[model samples]
Target: MNRTWKNRGIVFTLALLFVTVEGFAQGNNNPPPKSPEVHGDQRVTFRIQAPNADSVKLSSSDIPGSMFSRHMAKNKEGVWELTSDVLAPGAYRYRFEVNGISVIDPRNTSFSESNENIWSLVTVPGNPMMDTRDVPHGAVAEVTYHSESLDRFRRMHVYTPPGYESGEGQYPVFYLLHGAYDSDDAWSTVGRAGFILDNLIAEGKAKPMIVVMPDGHTGPFGYGDELPMDEFIQDFKNDIKPYVESHYRVKANRENRAMAGLSMGGAHTLGIAIPNLDEYAYIGVFSSGVFGLVNNDGSVVEASETAYVKQNSEVLSNDDLKEGLELFWFATGKEDFLLDITRATVTMFEDYDFDVVYEETEGAHTWLVWRDYLIEFTPKLFK
Candidate 1:
């Protein structure tokens, strides 16, 4: 009986050893998946194993111009791979489409979402302007405040620069605004604003200040629809500005306050900040301008060269407007669709002797240009 039991034990141990060896061999045969691989030259290669998929395509946020989609090729291993051209160093959003259905990269964990879409994110390092450097980083906090105008609790992302916790002095504030179809999180997530500011402040290129990104949408309007400008501006004044000033360590003065925005937010800056110049000393309008005026009766009045000048005549003609403002900077990409309107607005400002620093770079109205605008604009603040 002892001999029989010992034989059974040996058989069980041998069977366990054989199963372990087989599992190890199988694991070695199948390598781990690597979806996004950033190359040395800033090009990125994305791969996905979709054996059952009939078709696969790539959609990346870094695509220049109007083309946002690219066709990907599938290999014999049922892996779809596509290498992007040399891209700029920044964070980008991308995803895959399998048989006409959008899907996130299964291997990538980082992602960002707008009101309409969810996209996988990839950070291409090596650019210090946008990259996270070995510097003292700031603290970002999401704070909620009650909005009297909107009659709801709105949230904002605030970035306090390095040494803010131990520092004693109140810093200047930059009320940064996001574009349409985006939330308050857009600046830090896709824009990389916090990292950009960190690098700038470390290098002494930008002043250590607080950046407040507020939700520009005041009403329940879908993407591409005109926002409630009056309500948004009122809320910013009545709710957001007061809340930020009372909560954060910020200088509550016009000289220390600045306002800037991109796209629809830029339009809001024009409509809100220009009239309230006493509130914001520095104003930046990027890739957008006053397309039209919102009447009290909620009517849309198309902006004309004459009408623009006529409506803002007092503000444009006032010598104090230019003298009081620290900077009135506007920039737009040369290929941006709104370049003509930006040019018209710049012309209007120049015609009235308003000291507006206008810039035109080589790109369209995308986050790339907006990020560049933030990097350039932040350095000029509180100087």
Candidate 2:
């Protein structure tokens, strides 16, 4: 912490930046490309300089593609360029893989949106984007711990309910998940989850519950299925759940437990909840795309919309599901692309003779919708 070391660190950082930029500019005729510019249409033109890299590709869960890859073409001088189509307004996490190493744009000084980890942000001009909302929010704590499964310390965020430390009885628990482009802190921070929970709890609208948000993004190939789904399941069933149960005085039962999330996390909630019918009693899906949409191969028949309807129709015709397993909830913003999928899910569940509460609001796939969904969904838990 001495002046000498601090000076050295600054010098080292500058040196690294110089080398990184120079390395890319060496053989290129063009100057380093400018930082991405977001337009009114939500299109983002991303430019990165990497002259030495043989190839570069943009990796993100927000962008739709079979490979989740957006290849950047290098100019004669080695600067790379690629532009994204009009994206939905929300927080989209991405990185530049210069050959292999994940990197943030050095030129863009937007600062890290994800705390402790560095990822850049492009704020789309709009009212409901995650970055634009103004609300009295809650604190976001990113605590790290050693995990036996990952063989290293991992991190998770715990959004303590508004009156968390103050009262008497143990509260219920809600395990929330984030979409593909988000991490544990995405909801509590960007999505205003903590603030929404705080307001609801203060108003005596929501049952007091411990909200546990964990990082759903594991990137072996950026947002690909190379991740260990079974390990994730085990971590939830064994590590996360047990850790929370032991640390916090949360009621441990299906009636007191709920699970929900946005997009990918919504799908994850369903995937985890349906199998563990005895564990989670309430389940919510907010603009869920991964599990609610088509399968990995892009086949229409494998879509959740189709599957839900088919299953529910069969169940209804046979008088199946006389005993409901869980409380099903679905919500999606009107402007969100995932609306179709959510609507289909509701119809399917209804057809199967299950009561599913559905909420369609005015917003897009951004944090605005997710936060709104949480505000409505949280009160329904443990009631």
What are the TM-scores, per candidate, against the unseen true structure? 0.85, 0.61
Q: Pick the candidate with the highest lDDT.
A: 1
lDDT of 2 at 57: 80
lDDT of 1 by residue, 97-207 (tens): 777766777677676655445567888887789997789999888787899888988778999999999989999999999877776777888889999999999999999
* Steric clash pairs (candidate 1): none
Q: Pick the candidate with the highest TM-score.
A: 1
Candidate 1: segments with Cα more than 4 A from true spot = 1-32, 219-224, 293-313
> Lowest lDDT 10-mer window, candidate 1?
11-20
- Over the full model, what C-alpha lDDT does candidate 1 score relative to the true structure? 0.79
